[model samples]
Target: MHYVDLDKIELKDIPKISDPDGRGNLSVVERDFLPFTIKRVYYLYDVPSSSTRGGHAHKELQQFLIALSGSFDVVLDNGKSRRTITLNKPDKGLLIPNGVWRELEDFSSGAVCLSLVSEEYNEDDYIREYEEFMLFKSS
Candidate 1:
């Protein structure tokens, strides 16, 4: 395992195009907004307010999380440091690099989380335990 700096985490504002008729806004995410090509896209919705999600770290996958409807808090940890970020706007996202541990919590009612990933789903690439994540980070 190698040491990954906590500074690599970042919040980016995605561009939104508004309709002229005052109907709604459109947000776009392209290759320019991310560090790598997006290979998968998914969303989490209808989560209960008391529930939490994402208690794991990826070995090589990079992800960008966006709040499409309501709001939620994302807690990121790199073994040595930790940071919490709130996402509330559809036009904004949080970038989580590889090897970082993430937890989603404090989801407001009707909150929707959209994720853009650099790779497809692979169970072997995920580190699901905190103790194992710490060991992986230190090695």
Candidate 2:
């Protein structure tokens, strides 16, 4: 597998519009803000505190994840390196590129994980096993 720089994976800001006179805040994710055109949108919510999600990697799929309600931890691995990122801000998002392993854990109560996907659902694109991911990286 070609080496991927873990440092390049960082949170991106979603454009925000502030409301005057103490009302509320609004954030927008425009078409030009993201590198990939979104083809699917989904969200995870009402999760148990001890439960975890996403223990797989994608071959050609890329995703942008956001914590729209509470917070969670995303553990990312790229064969030779690993890192953990905390998603706690609604206006910030994390982009997971293809060929990287990811796991979501440590979800706070009422946490919501919203995903903007680059492709439609396809079972063949996922690498569900860690061993298989390692092998795919080497090839």
Candidate 3:
């Protein structure tokens, strides 16, 4: 089987149930829709100019990123192909699997990026260097 690539990043659109009163609508993300089980939820707010985040690759964890407030670009690399995705809607999210290095850059004013992580934080599970990530992906 071909290895997963960053360009293969999947986009999922969360559906909102219609309510007659239009109050308290509910949305859900099915486990089958995601590659992994979500175990954590976090968000990034107040990014400074020329600043970037998530310049690393996970070994086993998967993440779904949603732009809850404004807009931002997510750059992903999988040793061969690279893709940049723009996130601007809260109902839409990108599913990034392990072995893909991702970087969040070019944040619009008042951007809030939410992340749903499959695994808990573990420093040993992250490959921070590009070269190291490439090597790990090849092997």
Candidate 4:
């Protein structure tokens, strides 16, 4: 892994259009919405609040994470500095670049985490161990 600046992680408020029925808001993410073209999309739901997810770093994956339903907190580490970001609005998302370690925790009930990735699933691209991640960053 290479050194990633913590300042590069950003929370973006996607444009939301209200429903004609005055019911709810809708946000769209086309290719123009992100720096990279999205190739994979996934979501996490029905998670216990005490459970934590995402304790790894990717070699070449960029992702945009959204709170589609409730809320959660994302803790980011770049092997030098750390930061915590809260995602509660459906129209907002966090843009995470490659080489940064991310952990998701403190999920509210009925919370849904939607992730849009720049690449397809590749297990070899992920560094699942913290020590290995640290070594990669130092190299």
Winner by TM-score: 2
Model 4 local distance difference test score: 0.93
> lDDT at 12 for candidate 1?
92
Off by over 4 Å in 2: none
| Cα RMSD (angstroms) for every candidate in the order listed | 1.3, 0.7, 2.3, 1.3
Model 2, 66-124: lDDT tens digits are 99999999999999989999999999999999999999999999999999999999999
Instruction: Give the top-scoring candidate (lDDT).
Output: 2
Encode model 1's per-residue lDDT on 63-118: one tens digit a residue: 99999999999988989889899999899899888999999999999999999999
Candidate 3, residue 114: the lDDT equals 94
Q: Candidate 4: where is the Cα deviation over 4 Å?
A: none
Candidate 3's TM-score reads: 0.87
Collision count for each candidate, in order: 1, 1, 0, 0
Model 1, runs deviating above 4 Å: none
Write down the TM-score of every candidate: 0.93, 0.98, 0.87, 0.95
Candidates sorted on TM-score, descending: 2, 4, 1, 3
Off by over 4 Å in 3: 18-26, 30-33
Candidate 3 per-residue lDDT, tens place, 54-99, comes to: 9999998888999888999999887888889999988889988888
Per-residue CA lDDT of model 4 for 107-137, tens digit only, reads: 9999999999999999999999999999989
Worst ten in a row by lDDT for model 1: 1-10
